[model samples]
Target: MKRFFLLVLCIFATSCTGGGSCAGKKEVAALPDTFIWNLYSDPKSIDPGLVQENSGSDVGVQLFEGLTEYHPETNEPVPALATSSDVSSDGLLYTFHLRQDAKWSNGDPVTAHDFEYSWKRALDPKTGSYYASYFYIIKGGQEFNEGKNTDGNSVMVKALDDVTLQVTLKHPAHYFPQMIAYPAYRPVHRKTVETFGDKWTHPEHIVSNGPYKLVSWEVQKEMVAEKNPYYWDAQNVRINRIRFLLIEERETALKKHLEGSAHYTDDIPTLKIPTLKSNPHYHDAIQLATYYYSINTKKKPFDDVRVRQALAMSIEREKITNVLQQGYPTRNLVPPGIPGYTTAKGLSFNPEKARQLLSEAGFQDPKTLKVTLSYNTNENHKLIAEMVQNMWKENLGVEAELYNQEWKSHLKNVEEGNYEVGRFTWIGDYVDPLTFLEITTTASTQNYSKWSNPVYDDLVLVQSGKERDPKKRFELLQQAEEMMLEQAPLIPLYHYGRPLLLDPRVKGFYGNLQDMHPVKFAWFEEEK
Candidate 1:
């Protein structure tokens, strides 16, 4: 312990300065290696298979590694645990050559069998992982998830050897390599999970193959992770410790940032974006996420296409954009800037047309029907819901009720179709349009709206499989988007862009659409 302290002091004292701690470099460096980050709220779960939102994903990414990962800067798929891989001539089979030196935090060898066990565990109906639908591209994956096939042999995933993983896809999927980078595909140590049971996700028993390992978790207070010595690429890891503080209030997090208590934060208030933009450390990145209202298509009056379109057209999205002041003012499902694909344009703002459509949908006086807008408790979400309420009242003389639920409850209610219109946002798991479009498929478990469009389903699922040309496949997806918009089951609002106040002390920070921060390549630098 004395030697470790002396080593940290030596690096900090000599590394000398830039970013934010220039004047206090010696004092800052004399302490233990630590990076303080902010978490807006409690993560739903640390288990990779159960994580569905960005809050959980951020922590999950640090504690686990999949077959591959998004390149820090480019957001492109790159090898991580896998040393090399090969694809069959038909593009249906992928054989991954795992790195033999990889080991979990508990010193267990990370092998193909670990992946086999973890993948099958996620697909197990008992696990109830919503993202398991992501693996449907693999042969028999859907059947396994639906419990139609209990035998493991029916699944396409196989461990041919200790270091080789073979996968057979239902059809050619060019983006399959990138898709594997998502947390649902991350491997868990079979022995660790079996021994610890539900406690396996606790910091004490958690075993991971990522660059860092969980050291302590204090629930709604904070969690800490230390560098994993057993990690295959541990030599390249620079940061020694990362501390995540669970802070719900944006103002509280910002106050901590100003006091030098934190080095990174994504919880800053949207209203502060304009003021913070002048600061050098203030950062903004275009995220592949959309904040939209999930209209329950199974119920009235939202069941009618015209009624849904009317409500969508009535909302003045530009007013919301002015407050956000980051992402694009879009009524699109897919965010812009995706390579080789155009975003889906749903409906435009026109109060006159909205009223006309509302009347046409059999509601002469829209105010006669009261609808509920359910959302999680957040300052921004509450304010947006208020804005929407006013918009509906002024444009169509409609009355809408607002209900605030906790994160987990909100998700359950949305998925169960318990509300008329619910607030929802989807951050892409991968850089493909399928990440955005697939969720709206009739078959997707993440389809909160309970919307089912048979023709729309075929375009994304059936046709994309048969179309060999990538361009043609994307076009088919585009047609699907157009068809879904024409029906208007989903009311598009605005795209999401993250505004971060990052401390210069934390060097080598890379921001992308996914907003994934891999701390392995990050290090502390003296602030200039």
Candidate 2:
């Protein structure tokens, strides 16, 4: 029966391709060991320490290996560069045993020292790593990054030997192994970075320790990564090469997939969702991510809690999500289905209360209040921005100017606090509420809104990490999220339902909660 079904599927696929021409058969027979991915946008930076965007990490994962990596099927963190690890009785100290077989793309040995140097570089103040706070779990890491301590030696990550690394955390964290899988913790070739400086990431200079090594990069067009011969698990890597295409338009990406030019694409036009739902290649699943608008709290008018709340309460999130046919409307930043954590309900659409709040915030004549709404250049984002603009105008008589910028520029403007309110999305780095909650803290570089509350910070940054009791820790996190929602520094819009197109020939690709599909395990099935 399964064979019969596959036969039918093949027939259907052929019929859809150029009116069942022999050309389609030839194309299928000639499928290469390369995985062509529509990355959708040009990655801002592929440097492990510097990558904060999803697109960059998608590419970074291909070219780097950390102590751990996400399991292809489960999204669970498993040992990668490290063969195994031992935890001390206190659970504060972790000792990782490096895999001796691990080697960089250039055939250099990957050692514990590489991990130590890469981690320290991330924490170095001069690196300007936006994700520096993620390493705060390590003792003295926060102090070093914040410039409170001048000694890098004080930070408790130490290479005990060429093959063993010792890390002492300020607090006990059971999920430390999982957290290390994040791109920020990946090791870079120390010598290559030192010699080339910022140019170390160029294909000619880069020495990576993952399944793939970047061979060519044409800015704004495509990046190609060939298999790394020296990678520790090279024997298991199926995909020999990966072509990351920078196709910004969703329509173009879908067209490329349909035309057999690309095997995988991260986006499809929202309007096409209804028709594409019937296609076998179409995949739509709720990811552990949230889309929201980051209000620059440091800016005037937005600084007022009432004003921020008014803006948050005014948006009809359901209408936007319904119209788009993607994502579940959400007021809470963290999506549901996390183990042992209950999502906190946030302020819903109440335009009457929003108007009252606006008046209370001293904007009696709402026309006097004008703000700019910024988003990256994408049709979906523009549509959402337009909906939001109209909602603000109609609900509270506030005028919102839509400011669109390309991906890189949008990231820069948000990072530098150059925009009033910016569209943003946060996908969980690990399977934890801390991944989303930590972004609201003052120390977080992801906190584009620049919203800070001491009480909220302590709960998430300090208390939650130290609490060994899962129940108590979750409660602390929930409280923090609730408090953050009341302040409304950012307006939560929806939990992401990522719609992707994957060619039938592609195998070993699973849609995990993180939406992260490591290409090392993916391969094209041989044509029958």
Candidate 3:
């Protein structure tokens, strides 16, 4: 799953001369053969192994090709680095045949050995990858990541030859192919990483196997990439270059889009939704994502289950969703519409019960239970935090201080357990109930709540993967979600919708559940 707050930036201009066409405004001319996107923020990390958020994955997908890639229209896994693959009858062994034509941007041949090294490096504990658990399905992956296994060779991933990669799984995973399409499974140029160390991802030093290669990155300002001629299918890659403008304000981003500076942008101001609902360029789709408040369970007051439950029960989710004019209000962690799975409901708004629960937890006055609510910088997040802050004060008589930080710093604060309650969002990496459920497991680095239970670990980490029967496996997952909800380590707010603005000239971008638009498949329409 992807972590990080969703938002965008733009500077507002006062006058539009010709109706709504922004006439007389000196429009930023669209560059021929280039696709300019308003990438919400500067990606925290472009390194696939360390990226845990959409900002990073969005750019990473353009620069690195995994064994499989998501289909433009369907999001189904399709061959990329690997031309084809075979699975053993037992479903535990996977053999991927690498594409002989594939080569890194630096002209080095892309081989199966790169995949083997990349997977092992991701699983290395020193790497501190939040997504390392994703490899646990591979045999010996968990042991190696947990430091229980010292030998890297013990992991089941291996390069049988220059073109063949073999992987042995601990159990059958029906979605293994789809899982490999995620950024965490993308291969890195082993030599580049070893030589440059932390600077390997710099624009000049990076060597990639995807359709595009980084040419420049101006930190919070912008990043530019040019098409990679060494890429296996480079001829079919229509866009010659991509400019990702790091815009942080929705109003400013909208203004830029209106001024013809951007071809595609997913950030829209909440207040402007009604006016833009019927605009030809406006697009909205339900995404496989959840926005919630993660409680620091190890911290005081939140350490009590009663306190956590009370906090959850006091949220007026319906009001928040209604105000934002976005998102489907939800109490369940897993969003609906996943095949073969049903969502389990959790705590609902009950001000009286919340007050009683606070009293029962030894905080009778409620006013004495003061806490801080932290969130990343964004207009919507700020508004939501204020709304929740008021709800807690009015319902439970609890006072909360609202703290905001930039996207990168906010993620660090949450990971370091620096807040009593923090705003968090998770966009599914792949379409599956487990993608959402597994993040809360005790050993999960994404578990910012710092809450754990043996039953949850057993159900999600151990039993769910091993259960071969689809129906039985889903039941175990549902049960695990219900158990976690009962403890209230997090308050599920809503399943958000991805609101986007696209120029009519943009083509090949399709709406999908995961909200992923691989730039390799997108192109600008020829001018008539």
- Candidate 1 lDDT (Cα, 0 to 1): 0.80
Off by over 4 Å in 1: 1-32
Clashes per candidate (backbone, < 3 Å):
7, 0, 10
Q: Which digits, one per residue and each the tens of the lDDT, describe model 3 over residues 318-362?
A: 999999999999999999999889888798888899999999999
- lDDT for every model? 0.80, 0.86, 0.87
| Candidate 3 TM-score versus the reference | 0.94
List model 2 lDDT by residue over 401-520, tens digit each. Answer: 999998878988888889999999989988889999999999887899999999999999889877889999999999999999999999999999888777766767766799877788
Task: List the candidates ranked by lDDT, beginning with the highest.
Answer: 3, 2, 1
The digit string of per-residue lDDT tens for model 1 on 436-514 reads 8888898799887778888888888888888899888889988888787767777778887888877766666666678
Q: List the candidate 3 regions with Cα displacement exceeding 4 Å.
A: 1-31, 526-528
Q: Which stretches of candidate 2 lie over 4 Å from their true place?
A: 1-30
